[model samples]
Target: MSNLSATSTAQNSSTPIVLTIAGSDSGGGAGIQADIKAISATGGYACSVITVITAQNTLGVSAIFPIPLEHIEKQLDAVFSDLNVVAVKVGMLADCDIIKLVAAKIRQYRPAFLVVDPVMIATSGDLLLKAYSISTLKSELLPLADLITPNLPEAAELISSDVPTNKEGMEKMIGKLRKLKFNALLLKGGHLIDDENSNDLLILPNHVEQLNAIRINTLNTHGTGCTLSSAIASYLAQGNDLLRAVQLGKDYISQAIAHADELDVGQGHGPVNHFFVGHANVR
Candidate 1:
């Protein structure tokens, strides 16, 4: 009975709970699988609502099957009823119906933080969302997000213009997104032809932060974006500020990339080692 009492107390005061409404990656590289790993690795409890499933590996995505809209809500309702979600991250909203359902749920539950990682294309040039869903995602889903982490390609599509490749042009692009009324814009600078390390520029309403990440020279970078955003969600769920969360997330991913630089997972590309051993402090 005493042990049960302790367990109940802990349950009542759950440290941090983050939810990921995303697709499932059977390879455990990206999607809901990566989301869970990233959250747990950063000291947060993960609750997931899978919107789709993909038969995928490091080489490429073989097939994708989106889950029904009703089932998506069922999963969300189940989690919301039981857990107090502090932060939510969304990825791979394959269709507009599912996106709308998710947006409504976000409004209803109103988590403290929400991060949207628009999974438009796969690592190996696969289209994830439908063409019709693009407009819906912009007008309906993105504005509600506390932060939107978009790469060079995604930022281009968001504003329907060419994304400037250089720093000056990139900052200008980030400026345009700032006027969109989002809490934060983490514009990833991965596509620019630069040196070894990558520069990610983050623009906010008042402040601007720059993250300098050492781009690991390896094929194992399949789930990087998913992992980064999930780590941010994990930190936010624990009551960290957006800027702090972003920094911590960058650090976490940098370490993950460094640890997995040599491990080979598939024929073409690979994944980061989320559970790398011998780390003294995680999160």
Candidate 2:
């Protein structure tokens, strides 16, 4: 690896200086922690503003600490006034006010890539966002997005109904989601299991591509969604195509899951290997 100076890094910063405004996961498996790791792993400088803090582990989320609206704005102000942010990845926007606040800031500083991960539910079946925030995200946020990455359940919540389990059903759901006005939609299929592989669909303007990966067999698959979205954001910052970024992001998550170790923190599910530790970037 070449040594990178802060000045040279800042001056010759890669194509994107990615930003993620999301909640914090204390376990460091997901949320802001995973975002930074994913961004760096994809070779981008990550700037983050936390929307809320979750006292969470592999077992479950215990408490939620929401930052004040003004504090969230202040964090954005500090970053926007100084650093040059290239792409924005939104994770858990906890409330309606946060959705509106982030939407306004994003419009003011329209970055090259705006990826929205409408984090309504986690893999552990936790309700991360409120009902009204859904409206705020659709009305005030989706219009400003370059890409919207929604998992199966999120797709259902976004369209206000059930998402189809098969390819045909996915097409119908993607159609409903496209009405929200995003340039692209990466409908993740982690929750959808047809046979064995976890298939994700990327719906762009002229075409749709299937991103297929063998599902790593492990219960230590927490934070996979957040990791994928942030990894894509980081790649976008580094000037990768949207489809390529998503593809690379999927590969990264697969590796993380395959190499996931027993952190032994929680009893139910385990966290992914974001650090990738002895694990190669096999994807």
Q: Give the per-residue lDDT of model 2 (tens digit) for 99-214.
A: 99998998787666788888988778899999877878889888787778898889899889886777678768866776777778888877766548888888876778898988
Writing each residue's lDDT as its tens digit, candidate 1 over 1-283 gives 0011122322344678889999999888899999999898888888899999999988788889999888888999999888978788999999988989999998888777789998888778788888778889988888888889988778877777686777777777866676565667899886675656678988777888899987767667888889999998887776666777799888888788888766767776688887777541454
Please report, as a residue range, the 10-residue window in candidate 2 with the lowest summed lDDT: 1-10
User: For all candidates, what are the clash counts?
Assistant: 0, 1
In candidate 1 the C-alpha lDDT for residue 139 amounts to 83
The TM-scores, one per candidate, come to 0.91, 0.90
Q: Model 1, residue 175: what's the lDDT?
A: 61
Model 2: pairs clashing at backbone N, Cα or C within 3 Å: 16-237
Backbone clashes in model 1: 0
TM-score of 1: 0.91
Whole-model Cα lDDT of every candidate shown, in order: 0.81, 0.79
Return the top candidate by TM-score. Answer: 1
